[model samples]
Target: MGMKYSDGFSKQLPTLATVGAALVSLYLMSQAMKSIPVGTAYSIWTGIGALGVATLGIFLFGDRASAPRLACIGLIVAGVIGL
Candidate 1:
């Protein structure tokens, strides 16, 4: 019974995470769009999301931290800053 509960909880984790992310993203985007160009806001939002996911993958999921990957991440941040 304990194993079944744990398995069910694990299965729901992704769904919960997705919903939480979406809600926060929507709220942030709406707030940002009020003061910035939609294109700029969206670009920055996506850039931040990509960088965050990459960092999490590297630290939590043991993703490869290759030079090219790090360089690309830097480029993304630079692009966001350029905006």
Candidate 2:
């Protein structure tokens, strides 16, 4: 959504913020690897990311939240918890 802004500053700010957020997330994930297994940590990280983005898309962009879509999200949550 921020990427769709017409002004240059608005567009660039969101892009920069996204880069900073990603860096922080990666750093935290790397730190978690000290205790958690590599495969499990990676799986949980990706699963949480996917679930967060999907859920936000529904609220922020008015993306569809149909039953099947929700069920898939539930599956991702379950997988993350199982890990």
Candidate 3:
């Protein structure tokens, strides 16, 4: 009777875990913001998120990066570093 609802309820775990991780995320984000302008925070956050997703994709899916991908990753790193 509850088979279909099981998947819906199970999704809460990831959602709650994300909320917890978000707290930790903001800590590093705060560190990233040190001496960085408020506007740059958006850039730094974007770079971090993109880099993490790309890295995870490579690790979990065995995705290969072309030269352009490497360059884009480099750019993201530089953006974070400069922030």
Candidate 4:
């Protein structure tokens, strides 16, 4: 949605915000790595991100929530929990 904004100030603000968010996410992951194994932390981080984005796409962007897609999301949740 932010990326859909026109060029100039509008685009710059969203871009900056995105960069800031990515930086913060990395920082948090690094902090988590202090106690959790790197591989486990990274997997869980990516899995949760994927699940969140997919869920948001369904509710916010009217993306299809088909049975297969939902199953895949469930699998992601299971994998994250397994790790």
Judging by TM-score against the true structure, name the best candidate. 2
The CA lDDT at 1 in model 3 is 12
User: Order of candidates by TM-score, top first?
Assistant: 2, 4, 1, 3
TM-score of each: 0.81, 0.87, 0.64, 0.85
In candidate 1, what residue range of length 10 has the lowest lDDT sum? 1-10
What tens-digit string does per-residue lDDT give for candidate 3 at 1-83?
A: 12222455476666566667777878877986787776788687878888987877777767897889889989989888986
Model 1, span 1-83: residue lDDT tens = 22233465576766566667678889989999999999999999999988988888898768999999999999999999999
lDDT of each: 0.83, 0.86, 0.74, 0.86
For candidate 4, the 10 contiguous residues with the lowest summed lDDT are: 1-10
Provide the lDDT at 25 for model 4: 87
Output the lDDT of residue 12, model 1. 74
RMSD of each: 5.7, 2.8, 6.4, 2.7
Candidate 2 per-residue C-alpha lDDT over 1-83 given as tens digits, one digit per residue, 9 for 90 to 100: 33434255456778787767778999999999999999999999999988998998899889999999999999999999899
> Lowest summed-lDDT stretch of 10 residues in model 3?
1-10
